[model samples]
Target: MTERRMVAAIDTSLVATAAAAFSVLCASTSFAGVLADSRWVFPALLVVVVVAALGVLGRRLHWPLYATASTQVAGVLVVLSSQFAEHAVLGLLPGPAAISELGELLSGAADVVRTGVPPVPAEPALQALVCLGLGLVAIVVDLVVVGLRSPAVSGLLLLCVFAIPASLSDTMLPWWTFVAGGVGFAVLLASGGQHRRWRRHEDREQVTRALFGPTSTAVAGTAGVIALLTGVVFTGVGTEGRLPGSVPEQFGGTDGIGLQPFTSLRGQLNRDKEVELFRVRGLKEPTYLRALTLRKFDPERGWELEGLTQGVEANAQLPLPEGTDIGEGDAQRVEIQPIGYRDPWLPVFGVPRFLSGMGVNWRYDPASGIVFTQTNQESRPYVQQLVVPKPTPEQLRDARGPMRVAPEYLDTTGIPPQVTDLAQRLTADAGTEFDKAVALNRYFTDPSNGFRYDLQTAPAGGGDALSEFLFRGKRGFCEQYASSMAALLRAVGIPSRVAIGFTAGYRQGDERVITTEDAHAWVEAYFPGWGWQTFDPTPLSDGRSALPQYLNSELHPAQQPSSAPDPAQPSTPPTDGSTPGGGPQDDQGARPAPVDPRETEQSNPWPIAIGVLVLALALLAAPAVVREVRRRQRVRAISGGAAGSAGLAWQEVLDEFRDRGAQPAATDTARQVATKLLEHHALDESGAKAMRALVVAVEREWYSANGRSDESLPETLRTVLDSLRRASPLDLRSRAFPRSVLQLLRPQP
Candidate 1:
């Protein structure tokens, strides 16, 4: 094949390889969907394959680069339009109708990105957007790598393809996907340089070489290294979100809700320092202040927040708790002041009878008794009248199970098999659903079970974290215990869900201070007539008390209230007090704070592994890079005189031959080198003639005062070098790398 055609072929292959790699990278976004099936994989592959086939056909037909690129782009648009036929104008290309459809799909995708967490199920619109976006990326990559002949910029375009999914994702892309993408980008650059070299030679032969040279191989090589390194870093790091102490300014109630409620629990648990959430006064006894309830459970997704009630005016009366008697409970009044705690839901101790000192945008969910605002509200003092019910064990035992409760409450289809088995085993001896719940609660609270309450330990299991905690590690804080118990209760035909809020803070006189450290989670099991009763499965430790007196069989004497204080009157003498930091003061007597598990400083071997790989690659390629640099510098230094430059070029060609094992002695003259080339038959007749011309030019430059100014000497030398390179059996690196220069640079004895 002619050198020009060979270079074009190489460029075409490079573009195809890069497009394929980018398609694979785009597939990483599939994991962001709830379904295991990837919607974009096939469509992305189709786009790349079609573009490559058309590009090859165009090259064979000797079409202009612009024409080929335009054809490829049009092919992509046609394929996409055909793929989404319903939206296409003629069912083959994007028209006005298709444009409208694309806009709608993009809008839907935006909504999903704004409100939903990662691993969301792939809706049709989202899948369409994925296909269209990847198709466009493929076209752009083709233009940059093959048409424009700028493979380094093509690497940046590939980076854009990879970045889209990586930035939006909550987890790292798979390591293998990253590896494939990086390799593809590197290959693209390497191949492009090889093709460019062939094109330069071809152009020189045609006397049509441009003044501006092609980009250096060094530039392409450097870009490839940097692109691969970027991929490694992105795949190694996890995306950050709401954990214990990392609560964002707009906690909730925004159009864009980045963190799920369960993730918020995790964030709270992972917090290292203490910040006050809120403060409360006039409470007759300690209790957990309810914030929000997560009702939908998915085995793979954990807990999901769905179907939340829309906001209502602040003055709207809140719904009473299911199965609870409003008239029979003790009426208590309390004042709450928010500090750092920022959630749409207002923290309340019990069923709120009335709320005061709140904005009109505040809304309430009567079913869950959660008070929230439409927009993020500033922490303001609020008064609440709550009806606190003290349900007896006897009453709970008499209540019915799934048969009597709402069907929605009994949904346990998402529970894993392991959780079901563990639940049955733990509650086998119990006689009733209520008894089974109690048994499950006791199983978690018992100190003899070897379960340790830890915040830093990762929850075990692939997607079934509850099963892992129950059967394996048996370690976690409030979230684990509460979520596990809820799942267990539902498994045994009982209705249950998890509630998140804060534990009653340290009582300094009459007021209590709640800190971020006080963030807690617990289960609420539903009964036929008794309503959803609070169950604390988290074991009390580090000066923390156990389950409330009503839930535990052997209640501590100190936990019992001194008197039945009137709900309408002050329960105790109000004492003027506040937390030192406007939040809960860190008690020196409390258990040592657990380390934040997600802290980046924790030991991880990925960065080390990437570093080693990069170092090893750099070491392997250093010789070739150094040789190339030195060769360029030497040529530039001798360029002042044409004869001298030609002589230097001839000498470099001899060194290349020597390096390839056709060892011409150091004392050999240019005439002797040409004789050796002819005797070995290393070149064709024309190449042999060129070699002789090079030798004659070098002799004039070396031996004559006014040497022949052979402007064509450089071209003649290059042709000779190319011929010798083809004749030698040695690999490209052994023949082309200037190792002889290194020997000359060495200090000899």
Candidate 2:
């Protein structure tokens, strides 16, 4: 009966332990997820994790979980832990962000790492990775704690349960399961209680089997369904979503419809804006701008810019196939930087000689000349390339296309006609297309004429964006310049369009991998014979946007560094004649003399003496401290009389010696273990005076008592140790003659 009760107690303890561990896991996971979601909440997340760790330990001791419903809730808590992890977190942890949002984080990391891994970008994805790892360990412990309660198979089942989440985040599990399960089963064979448990656990076996019976059919069916759905979604979303998490929910609409933000997580996630991704293919990447369809602007039902869809039919405008959309022209590649496409209506570089990318399923509008994708903001990371036509300046100068004037163009295009008139006036004086391009380019670049380009960082004027740019603001970013220029050119009876893309950025040794900071926008004008001519109007005035360096860097994850973003910059032009991102301009002819080495050294005493002192202390003190610590540990390990030995007192003595600098290296074999003393380890010239007492005690023990001073062993040991230390390695080496005479004396004795 007692044996049966003990067995029952063990079984109960195991269940309780597993449940308790699960509770800790859930609580910790939920809090961690929260921190991972919002980096600022990390401290709170850490605290919860520590608390949960304590609970995990307590659970391993078999704390019961049948206490309340709160216990069950604890298991679920883990699902929500780790919130708002930064992109840099990925690099720091073995585990990655969940499959849902990791695409952008990791790919961004991969890109950052690619550009000379040495000066790495400081991204937050690495921290998120650590959280991922910790969460997994906690989950595993919870399972193993339970499994150990019964047979080893129980451990496997527990592992499978915990694995569900790990697999959800990092899906390389089938292999891990095979390896881990194999090793575990191998060990199960060695357990001695299995035979007895198998005979006695008939009831438990039945219960376990019933709860987790064969679901091969269900598993097979799930695989089939997943495969079919995956195929359909793939066909619908396009190649842009090759990486998981690449597709945002906003991009998954049908043939006529398109992708939009995932409304299901409205409160859980904030999809403030769609990320702008650019791709260049062919001649050069003409900037690809997302055409905003503006029909019903409700200020509340999201922006109504232009061409958005409402369904899913796996359809978007495919690129103009090899022989479509063009009559021969120079080979070229059009680059696109898709800003948030407010509506489905897409903007392009005049004639999109070819089109294929995310949201490319919309029907082309011949009247307005817009080709919108059938998807919304959350569908995918969009990047498309095309062989866009580039016309020569000579061709564009003599070309005039049929003009159509619609006052309603103001409403449909949502732009004022005055903006277009400006373009015409700007180009009126030019004789050739090239001349016009040169004139516009020169007007913007002239140093005397102070127009500048910068991404607006300050608070904006209330109301319409158009008014804000024309009257209230003197400086505009690349998009603003491109838009105004296009409007101006179009008004001059010229078929022109605004395009968005990255401008040429710093290119090293040849890989040509573009960075997020390179995101840019420009303009393209249609010409009669040659094709479309590209023109840049944004004055490269010196003012860098105060974006954190990483946000604009190709090196690290998008982590904001402390030095970035000049927050104190005022909006008005500086009296100093320098631009915002450019800093206070300096005279070009300044130079300075080189510094003297002696003066440089004089300024830094801490770096010289202090650094040396610290290093010396570490090297000289470590071995002694380690040895004493080891000796103390041994004292603690032994019992009774051995424990009462002078080991503890000697440890204290060693510590004092170290404090006074009598440190010995572990590799230093014992030699004149004595004179290391007189020259060093002693209390001044009292060294020999002090040495007399110790030598006499050792002599008596050695000669008269046969090396045994049982009653005074501790005192004798301490004295001999002190003398040995006095012998000093330096003194011993120099005093070899005395050592030879001492050897003769020993023989006589």
Clashing pairs for predicted structure model 1, backbone only? 32-119, 34-120, 243-267, 243-268, 244-267, 244-268, 276-583
Q: Per-residue lDDT of 602-684 in model 1, one digit per residue for the tens?
A: 35665336545755676677677656644564455345453246546665665566566565554555577578766774587
What lDDT would candidate 2 get against the real structure? 0.36
Judging by lDDT against the true structure, name the best candidate: 1
- lDDT score, candidate 1, position 499: 88
Q: What is the lDDT of residue 352 in candidate 1?
A: 79
Q: Model 2: per-residue lDDT, tens digit, 442-522?
A: 554343444445443122466455435544564555545555555545455444544433333222232122333334445
Candidate 2 global Cα RMSD: 18.7
How many steric clashes between backbone atoms does each model show? 7, 119
TM-score, structure 1 vs. true = 0.49
